[model samples]
Target: MIFCIKLPGGLIKWCRVINFKESASGENPGNLKTPSCFLPSSKEPVRFNLYTDFIPLQKIVTNPNLSL
Candidate 1:
């Protein structure tokens, strides 16, 4: 799965790929945060849209041979 985050006022000057770490243990599982993908402005409002080919989570997680 890929996320398409939209930024207001052309704030997305650059983006950095990051990997999020899963939570250790709690009601919230498999939650993680990526290092901030810096924007050009701090006051801009941003929106995110996630996209995927509708591949099953099992296929996405299990297939090490697949290339993004």
Candidate 2:
């Protein structure tokens, strides 16, 4: 699933599905298994707010036929 986050200035950022896995027995309830990156640019440094909370697959479905 892809997650689109809206920034303060109405800019939308997209996060692709890099990798995923089911939680282990002792793992945290809502943790992402993959590490995400910020887009590089010529401007000053960009800081992003990361959310580890797992959103349901139904919420971010831009295309239902596309594979994660």
Candidate 3:
């Protein structure tokens, strides 16, 4: 899952949870602990719409693997 977290200096940044480790012997069995692998976004933030600015229309049409 992607999250927008505020840092100590009140800066907002994007990060993604790569792994979810479940807590053992806890009150809730299905409860999840902190993310084992948290990956920060490397790319710069976009100002416009992602679909229009980030991805090219030509690539989207030619690349069959690309999905909306």
lDDT tens digits, residues 1-68, model 2? Answer: 45565656677866543332223332543544433333343134233323444444775696577554
For model 1, residues 24-43, the per-residue Cα lDDT tens digits are 23333433332223333446
Point out the worst 10-residue segment of candidate 1 by lDDT: 17-26
Score each candidate by Cα lDDT.
0.40, 0.44, 0.46
Question: Which of the two, 1 or 3, has more lDDT?
Answer: 3
TM for every model, in the order presented, reads: 0.21, 0.32, 0.28
Candidate with the larger lDDT of 1 and 2: 2
Best candidate (score: lDDT):
3
Q: What's the candidate order when arranged by decreasing lDDT?
A: 3, 2, 1
- After superposition, which runs of candidate 3 have C-alpha atoms over 4 Å from their true positions? 19-68
Off by over 4 Å in 1: 1-5, 10-13, 18-34, 44-56, 59-68
What 10-residue stretch in candidate 3 is worst by lDDT? 44-53
Give residue 42's error in model 3 in angstroms. 13
Please give, for residues 1-68, the per-residue lDDT of candidate 3 as tens digits: 45565555567876644333233234444433433233344343322222243577788889969985
Q: Residue 31: error of model 2 in Å?
A: 12
